[model samples]
Target: MNRPTTLREAIEAADSILIGAGAGLSAADGDHHSGPVFDARFADFRDQRGITDAYSGGFYPFPTSEERWAFWSRMISLLRYEAGPGQVYADLLGLVSERDYFIITTNVDHRFQTSGFDKEHLFYTQGDYGLLQCSVPCHDATYDNEKWVRQAVASQEGMRIPSELIPQCPRCGEEMTTNLRVDARFVQDAGWAAAAGRYEDFLERTCVDRVLYLELGVGMNTPSIIKFPFWRRVYDNPEATYACVALDASAPAEIADRSLLIRGDIAEALASARG
Candidate 1:
């Protein structure tokens, strides 16, 4: 049988599904870290600072907190609020929504939540654009930034937010930063811990069942988190199947027979599998 048909059969046969997603999934959905949208939204950064994309923009060392918050606020609004969960995410959800499934993703955009996945069944290992934590990490907590982000995006001028709008950590008065897992300073708040526990629980409950480890658009940026784990689990569980759909896909020879590798467009592969 063809790869997509084989993937369809695997999904149908599995008692539970575990989805692992990465930046490629969002990129395939046109929500790239840097692209036309980034260029258009951050033209000033591109022209003046040579900061081309959201990914690099986050790392840019702005001279002032006002400038830093201005860039970040707009980025959060654009990536987290303004961008829609494109057809790729929706299509992927459609294929697994009817089954017992859980999703673990490194992408910070919250696309799975936006695409109608149950929040309780999803684990976002890399934090979120919609959350902010102290740069010094004064406490183990994150603050919601939607209201502040939209406000800053509206009130900013000259690529600087009004000094008054800059978020300060409520506990220690330190400056706030995106809650992404870029460094050791990243905060794992109560919600994050709870989600992690639930993910572990899901794995324990389903480990012996006929599980399908479906990885979508995952790449080498963080193999240990999803890609490697999926391979290891499939190797350990004879009843399990491993399927990967990405622009590029590969698997070790040991589990080659149990692996269904589809190297192509993610959306197309998902559609074919669902058929």
Candidate 2:
């Protein structure tokens, strides 16, 4: 059988699926952090400060908190709030929507949830773009930032947000930052902990069965969170199958016997598999 059909059959036959996603999957959906999209949206920053992409801009040292929030607010609105469902994510959901499936993604874009995947069935190990927490993380709490982001995007002037619109930690009056896991200060609030628990419970229950550890677009930036564990699970469980789909996909020689590697566009592979 062909590769796509092989993948489809594996998905159909597996008792459960654990999906590990990374940036490539989102990129296939046109959610790019750099390139033409970034150039167009952040032209001012690029021309004035050599800040080219959203990722770099996040780390840029703006002169003041107002300017910093301005950059972040624009990024949050563009990537988090305004972004729409991706067809690749929808295709993935369709492939295993009826099966016992759970997602563990390092992606912070919230694409899976917006694409109609069950929120409870997902573990976003990295923090989300739609959330804010204390910069010092004085407390373990995350606040939703949709309203603030929208307002900031609408009201900002000359690459600066009004000082009043900058988010402040409710508990300690310190500056608030995106809930993304840039450092040790990233908060793991009640919701994050609950999702982590669910992921662990799912792993405990499914690792023993005919599980398909389907990894997509994952890279080497942070392997421990999803890639390494998925490899270990498949190695330990004889009934498990490991599949990876990416533009440059490969498998460790140890798991090669039970692994399926699809090296190509993630969206195309998903579409062909679904067919």
lDDT of 1 at 162: 93
| Overall lDDT per candidate, in order of appearance | 0.89, 0.89
Which ranges of candidate 1 are over 4 A from the true structure?
Answer: 1-5
lDDT tens digits, residues 1-275, model 1?
23224678878888999999999899889885787878888998788889988878888999998988889988889899998888888788888888999989999998888889999999999999999999998789898999999999999999999999989889899788889999899999999999999999999999988889999989898999999999999899988889998767899998888888888988787777767
Q: Clashes in model 1: which pairs?
A: none
Model 1 clash number: 0
